[model samples]
Target: MKKILGFAFAIALAFMASGCTMMKMGTAFIKLEPETQEAYAKMMDSIDTYGDPAKAMMIETKINDDVTNDDAVEAIKAITEERNMRVTGDVKMFTKEDAAPDEVKHARIISVCNLTTAKVFLNHSRYYGGFMPCRIMLVEYGNGDRFLITMDLTLAIKGGKPLPPEMLKAALIVKDTMETLIKNGAAGEF
Candidate 1:
């Protein structure tokens, strides 16, 4: 009995250590050079200023230290999977030097929306409060290049309902605003 308890304890300790390691890794920030960090900061700031008509509604952009681009992608997938929303898109990268005029630098745009929700709920699904999904946009620039990624996220409703069209529109506007900042050389200014 003593030997069995000792083995069990060892297993528990190992499990705990692994869990801790995973948590640490998940919470860690992606390492960026000083210039890169500054550029990101400025680009975010420009989001509140440049993008189309919504620029007036733009407030100060907030940067989340714990929220890495990879984590954002995973979180959206995990959250939507519970609600039967399958994330199907990917982040596409664009460099400034290679991009055309009036283009963005280091842009990654991911589109994650629920076709299932729309098919099931139709127009009435917009009334569901938590059903309005989210889209996460991330942009990184360094070594004289910029990158951006966007992903859609949503929650499952009890009735298999979808988010409202207006909600989706707003999310798109926000993304466009970010793109505008990149186009205006916000990355270089930072």
Candidate 2:
């Protein structure tokens, strides 16, 4: 049984070496919480990987390849209004031409909120508000490629476990809303 024990130890070591990414990846499913649909997950997986892998493991990321920065912005605006959520904040990043002009072609953060969900999430942990107003990053490459990056909320909001039912529900609702918004925006559709 020494060989079997060794194999198991190796597997455990592999998971631990990756900063617990294996666990975070399944936090929602492990907790039986709602997660991104299969099609959506697959789409995200197929996109061009442009960031640090180590950073990726710590968060939920969704990226779309076909949507332009402008298209994504318009789509998000339409979605927020249709869904009765308010656009909470918009920030443009990495824009100093002298610093790293070509590194970031286009990078804008679009954040929106369903106030009730905000209230519930905040009630669970006021600090959680730091993650507020579901946000998506609209990105463009100097080579003319475009992408929309979405944050998955299940882990940040519900993966903690032992959260109240209302908090979980609110988290799920906002997570679903964020996914729908990104998918629709990325496809250039309403």
Top lDDT: which candidate number?
A: 2
For residues 1-190, write the lDDT of model 1, one tens digit per residue: 9999999999888987876666666444343222444444444565656653333322222234444545544544554455444555656555455644445445554444456444444455454424333333445544332233222121121112233566455434534433332222222321
Candidate 2, 10-68: lDDT as tens digits: 99888888768757776646554344344345334544364443334233333455655
RMSD, every candidate, angstroms: 18.7, 9.3
Query: How many clashing pairs in candidate 2?
Result: 0
TM-score of 1: 0.33
Full-model lDDT for every candidate: 0.43, 0.68
TM of each candidate vs. truth: 0.33, 0.62
Score candidate 2 by TM-score against the native: 0.62
Best by TM-score: 2
Show the lowest summed lDDT stretch of 10 residues, model 2.
53-62
Model 1 misplaced regions, further than 4 Å: 1-51, 54-63, 96-105, 120-135, 141-190
